[model samples]
Target: MYGAVLADGMGLGKTFQTIASLYSLLTKGINGQPTCRKPLILCPTSLVQNWGKELKLWLGERVVPVVVDDTRADHVKKSFQEFRAFGHGGKPKVLVMSYPCFRMHKAEVYRMGLDVVMCDEAHFLKNGEAQITQAVAGLASAKRRLLMSGTPIQNDLSEFHAVFDLACPGLLGDLKAFNKTYEGPIQRGRDADATEKQVTLGLERMEQLMKLCNKFMLRRTSTVLKALLPAKVEQVMVLEALLKGIKASEPTDKVVLVSNYTEALDVLGGMCASHGWPALRLDGSCSVKQRQALVDTFNSPEHPSFVLLLSSKAGGVGLNIIGANRLVLFDPDWNPANDLQAMARVWREGQRKRVWIYRLLIAGSIEEKVLQRQLAKQGLSKALVDDVGQQVRTFSRDELRSLFRVDPTTPCDTHQAIKCSCSGSLQDLDSCKERAAAAAAAAAEGAGSGAEQQGVLGWAHLARALDSPDPTWQAVSDFVRNNFVTYIFSDHVIGETQHCL
Candidate 1:
């Protein structure tokens, strides 16, 4: 028998619905006998503890929670080895694990013959080739399976196929046939007539597939779940003066106010080396273990308060940093969805108090234009591919002129109160003024002709300097490159000889 999937939006209680469903299953006496087969709840590691907490609150003493933290190969193997032994004997009713650990112990998970497999935030398996997706696909033999996600299609239709494939394999047929019939024509940006034909056929097929797998999947939205909760307060905190630190400066208090990810990674790497942890590159290329360790350290209270560098591509979703109450977005990303998800990590339920989110925008740069487009797009209730195309056509010329007019010398007098915007109290006005002045100075420096002379360098340059062939060049190169971006901000271009080298 297949179960339903409750894919409610963020801040809507999908967690609560999951717990209720599990409780209903647990209460039913199977064949007049108490069933001991526990459900397997697979989720991101950051949410493992959250799920455990929720389960304890709902079912209290009726369920057992086992969290798998496999730091090494042996640790992972040993955990699964025990799961197989205990699971076969009709042990606990629920086992929770992170997606990473689930993949490592997939063979054991299948061998244990779980009754129900429930995946939360299931969008992690959107990429068909990812290890976790393959592992999930292999678990189709379970008695019941449930897949859950809020925004199932963040980008395109192909992502939906991966989730559906896991829930009901043959229903969608195969990827090739599915794509040729539906996605192939639609993704081409076909004419209105062709697009309508494709959508009509696609929805018909989708309806049939839903009917076939009606017992397996269910999707719910926020509007349907609103009645279940009480009135809530939403607080918005805006820090408009923060500068995106693409340019570097000396270690001043203002510099610390908004450190770019590159600088944060450098500092974190040094700290890791000093603490005997393997030095980590906080780029997208880092291994899973490296990232987990960095996250553990950052969340630890004993560790010095420091910035964590995260690439939006890798760290935008699934990762949670519990200790961070304040967020300074160094630069805006291309996708509004990615940025919103990244910010949601700090604003989620477990947060103890009001969280402050700061978005740094370079007043007259391409960054500002990007924000403008995001705001404009958010206002539209319907899709506007044609309008977007027309805007893109005129974007370059209009954006260039706007970018040149970002004057930092002009006073930014806008002010809204923290908790109550209508309070009219001006206690924080002085602090806001100082920040505005600093932002203006930074923007003015960025707008100057000198900024163009300060050529940008890649991560490779720093990597080479750190491991230079010549010992003499090591110190010199490191010092020069370390101060390169900062020096450029000062209207002096140093290490021009190393430009080609």
Candidate 2:
């Protein structure tokens, strides 16, 4: 049995490559047996149907797409068991299921005796403790395993361990040893020289492990698939602004601001609508149905709309909206991965024209800080394209002072400032000290208090809440007896309390 993962960059057709690999393996017999045993492709719920569609297009009539949803659990299990009983018989049987469904039916899946399991967007199991990871691990004991992800390791190298652990257990010793060697150092950023040394050694160990698993694994990138993709272009639009309030009051009045969506819509809507582009408004407030409908409209040629207003939270994952040459990120997300994924939405296959990515930045506020953090995370030098990827620049005291400029009128004592300079390192040290002090204070306060802490309501409480009888009517009667507050007043009180909380 062998397992492999294709960790390509986003917009690089990972799905297509996985499909191609499966197709080639199935078409050619392995060890005198057809290399298909009802391969299971596990993915996110939003992408389940999309996977089914892709399978139909790639495998044609040779494969059957089993869509597993919550309502048809028994039906799905019976069908899967039937397929397993029948066996592939020299053909492939592909079962498409979401991560949640896989968790709900891992036993059935294991009992059905699947020959191969392919996890799409495999990063969902990055957290080793997650239920999905455990379920996938249970399935990994099967004959073959395949992991597919664009970002196989994000934020920390240990994420790679989680994927490999599922695909090929015992390759990495365990989470503890792996973290001490790889994850701990990677996350320590620029300060961990000892950690970096460990990382260097760990990479070598990883390479050796890869060789041990060589018969089962393969990795590729989008650059390798360049022949299959169109040219792409990214554009950055910078907006400059200064503090609108008086200098004296600016420090106190500074607000945590985000782009006004209503105002943003007027601007983006005009640009996209002018080009006869259909607009897809995707935000946290919109329901799943609304988001999907917008995606459908955006993908339709009859609509031909280019403008898509996407919320970072909702559009960050499992969305495959494509074919718009232009992309406008109305606001910046704190996480670079989130922004990258959003940008990749337009850069996927079938996009013939150059993809133009427009990042709208509000000049001087936290937006600039957000952009700088994003660049730093990418191992780039600065926030702008010119300064990126050169050399890592350490901030001096004066430079740090300039970056986080305080209004001259704001109270500042030169004597007090002498205690700690404004260098980045000094600021970090001060932050650590402050956190320690706060923790000490909290500990002291908690120790002094004799209050008994109550645990959260459990499942029994939830069941009782659901089954309680006459409680609603009794509560209403008690409320009237206590104080004949008008229905409007009671409603207002409840609404106000909910809003305040």
Identify the leading candidate in terms of lDDT.
Answer: 2
Alpha-carbon runs more than 4 Å astray in model 1: 1-4, 29-36, 81-93, 185-328, 346-358, 363-501
Tens digits of per-residue lDDT, candidate 1, 347-437, equal 4545454344455554335655555444333212001111111111112333333544554432111110011132122342343333334
Q: Give candidates' CA RMSD values in order.
A: 15.4, 19.9
lDDT of each: 0.48, 0.52
Candidate 2 lDDT, 1-501, residue by residue in tens: 367666666776788888887776666656655676557888876677677778888888786666654437676767676566554454566777888877887887777667678898888888888888988888744557788776665555566688878877877679898777544543343332335565455445444544554555454433343465544333222211111111122222111112335566566556545645445666667654456567777666576443466655566565767645445566877656667677777767776653445455433445545554554444321111111111232322343345454333322222112232322222233443443344334335642111001000000011111121112222233333223211110000111111000
Each candidate structure's count of clashing pairs:
1, 5
Winning model by TM-score: 2
Provide the lowest-lDDT 10-residue window in model 1: 381-390
